[model samples]
Target: MPYCPPDCSCNLDGTVDCGGVDLKEFPRNLSESILHLSLQNNALEVIPMEELSRLQNLETFNLQNNRLTSKGLPDDAFCSLENLLYLYLANNKLTVAPKYLPKTLVSADVAANYLTKIYPLTFGQKPNLRSIYLHNNKLTDAGLPDHMFNGSDGVGILIMSSNFLKYVPKNLPKELFRLHLKDNKLEKIPKGAFDHLSKLRELYLHNNYITNDGIDNETFWKLSSLEYLDLSSNNLTQIPRGLPRNIVLLHLEKNAIKSIPGSWLTQIKNLEYLLLHNNKIKAKAIHPLAFKGLKKLHTFHLYNNMLERIPSGLPRRVKTLMLLHNQITEISRNDFAYSYFLIELNLSYNKLTSPKIHPEAFRKMRLLESLDFSGNNLNVVPSGLPKNLHVLRLKENEINSIPDGSLSGMTKLKELFLSNNKLKLNSIYPGAWKQLTNLQLLDLSGNQLSYVPTDLPESLEYIYLQNNQISVISENAFESTPNIKGIFLRDNRLTTSRVKEIAFEKLKFLQVLDMGAYSESATESKKDGGTSGDNLENDSEQATQNDK
Candidate 1:
């Protein structure tokens, strides 16, 4: 029967909750036997030290989202709670690390504060401390004492990102498993900065100013357990030498790197994801055997570069290859000769035309699933696409016709996007989509169609035919497709008199039928009290909500 505060709730398990009550001061008459207390999301400006010291059995303290300042927190605010294991003082106005923290602290989150410095003995002698989150602070390199974490042998994760540190902090705990210093001003890594952190697994240093000359050759060679490293958005002109051989994921995008040496990554056999987009990498600068030994690499992103053709030696086991937004004009037969496991390939926004693309360019990718050839200059659909493809995007091209037998083998195709092309109703061959039994969506919007194309797949669920010159939808236009759910024929020349009610009679699952903005003359006919035009529009609207 312990006394609970008037505005708070108390549990029999020694937990008290008083968060988000617009509390301006700490609640009184709190049970001394309480083990957990929450006072977050309040305007608590000061912590009454003498009053809080009575709760010696308290193990977790949360004062996050308060107005606690450095001067208000006394030197012995949290030192008296001998059993304090978790402390959360984040989103406060503290200008320095709280001093005299109990040695029993396991995790402390002081993130999103105005902390500018950490005293020498702030986290020095805590052997049980494992995590310290001080990100989004204003701490500089000089503010972090060299021996800040001197005696803390068990500190594992330290997040100091979005700071103003100019150099890597020295004498870090040897048992660190993850360190995040991204969004900092780090310019150099002193020779032995990370030599002692043998158990470090992930290091994030992106959005910094680290150049190749500033990184010592042996800086990251001693981290045997390192697996993920991000050096994106930096000033490096080339790939830094002496990266850990066992790393799995490497991110080097948004750098000024121009060339990748042949032997740079030959030893990292465990690499899986490599991102090098938004750089100045040219096709000739990539050595013939640059990516020869990466067997486990599945995702490679080299888009937004100055490459005229596909690089010679891509990873053989890559499953997703993104080479869009480049100067690539053609795909030779041998470009993807060894990529047998590729599933998704995007070659959009390149200078590729139909004649420049070799017929056998994509012949070896039998397992391909999604192919995007959009934003190109092709007069017809490219041949030799994989039959197992499920999604194909040929939008924003000059494609005027689909040659017969071009898509007859792709039985598993599901979605086709041919919007914003020069396609007309007569340009599509008869039964062009006859073999596509699994097709679900067809997008032919922004085309030059005067009539709806016939012989659509029966499995179609959605069709987009907006932004065309279609003046009439034949009575049996959708007779072949019965499972269609949505039809977007907006912004066309469809009038009320031309639309027959029987055209949409068989679509039982239809939900949306938007025939946008009729002419003023059509609306005048409805105003003249004609039931023919009004009934036809009303019946089509009623069909959209059938069987729901």
Candidate 2:
């Protein structure tokens, strides 16, 4: 009953059911009443503007993902829809826009197209136009006169991500709320580029050619409502001076940031969710009280950084902490003596000999539900863990053995991750994982295990055992784990036949059988179905090393 894609003007105004269909041209049955029409992912060579001219009541139009290289719309094609609001024409092989359209149009999204440049005085008369998405285009302000976007006040969103913008355009509108210019070729953002966006809130300029030397005085003095600012994926080796005090989320990941400049964020009290991951910041150089007054901070991620050890004391009010992919050797005493309401901790991808835990280290943490200690060299886990630990990720480690009662204090443990650990012994302590009745996911990739132990929880849903030296998987290896959704046994020396087929039939909820470390083709297997799997983390790793 409900099937229409976005960027189409329907009377009901719902953007759905419009993707990758084999339509020759625009739909004629709904042409008149359609407010938004999208002929995307179709074999239509001609856009058939005459069909659109008949639609007087249409308000929105989307012609993306089509073979319309010739962006020639009749001058009066949209003269009927005087009350039109939004328009999207992305991925249409467009080079230059028609420069003629309705006057009442508000939001225009032309991203992922071939828009090379904009003509002077083009779209300057559209007073009500706001929220222009021009990302993934070849736009450049090099030849145009400065002072672009000078008077567009009613604008709200300007997504110019992945363009050739060398510097911030001059004379920006003050009413802008969200401006995304990430993955561009911007070398610098002149002080005047942000001079007028006083009411701006979210500015995304990540993956640019910018550095801290480009930041000038009054860097962020106007934007008081600025909350989510992403300066990550840049060439910034230092934090800019004089940021707005009201910023809540600052993403500085994947940069050449070596040390945070003092007095840069000295007095921001409302700041929360500071992501300094994938940088080259040393552990000792980071100030413990740098987040001193941010009591409301709930999430602080510093994974994939250049820290050799955990910072001794951080802000006491942190809830979620991520410290993966660092060079951490061991957890010293009083390493985390500050967190009072700590909920989640991730210490994966390090060189720890063992997951050493100190007494009362997590005693004050009450709501912790997740912990990722994967990709480390831990031989064993220390005693005295928190009681309510739900998820324990210790994958890709060098664990040889775990003594009896190693997880005794962890009574309410739900998931115990021991993937990629060295298990040489055949007999595990009775009831070693008995307390973990609610265990779910267990990944044992890249290990020297000969056989899977029979002590896993029954509530396990997902299991990964690829890239191991396992030669046999007994029928009782997963005897009681009926809720298992997926099991991986590929790329191993499985001497037994009928394992993959047998495991799938036994596990009622079997969905996937990831084997051999997920071949490179399986990268884009996600819910969104987009083939561009996140290469951001890898890029961030290289950026961190480059900055250091």
lDDT per residue (tens digit) for residues 1-548 in model 1: 79987778889999989898889888876878999999999899888887798899999999999999998888789878999999999999999998778889899899999999898767888999999999999999878888999789799999999999999998999999999999999999988999999999999999999999999779898999999999999999998878888899999999999998999888788899999999999999999888888899999999998888999888989999999999999888889899899999999999999999888888889999999999989889998888999999999999999887789889999999888899987888788876789999888888999977788889998888877878777789899989998787765676766777699988899877766555445455334432232232233442222111
**Cα lDDT tens digits for candidate 2, 69-127:** 54455434556667677777777776765555566778877788777765433344567
What are the Cα lDDT values of the candidates? 0.87, 0.67
Each model's number of backbone clashes?
Answer: 0, 12
> What TM-score would you give candidate 1 relative to the actual structure?
0.95
The alpha-carbon deviation from the true structure for residue 141 of candidate 1, after best TM-score superposition, in angstroms, is 1.0
Model 1 has an lDDT value of 0.87
RMSD of each candidate relative to the true structure: 4.0, 9.6
| Superposed model 1: Cα runs more than 4 Å off | 520-548
TM-score of candidate 2 to 2 decimals: 0.75
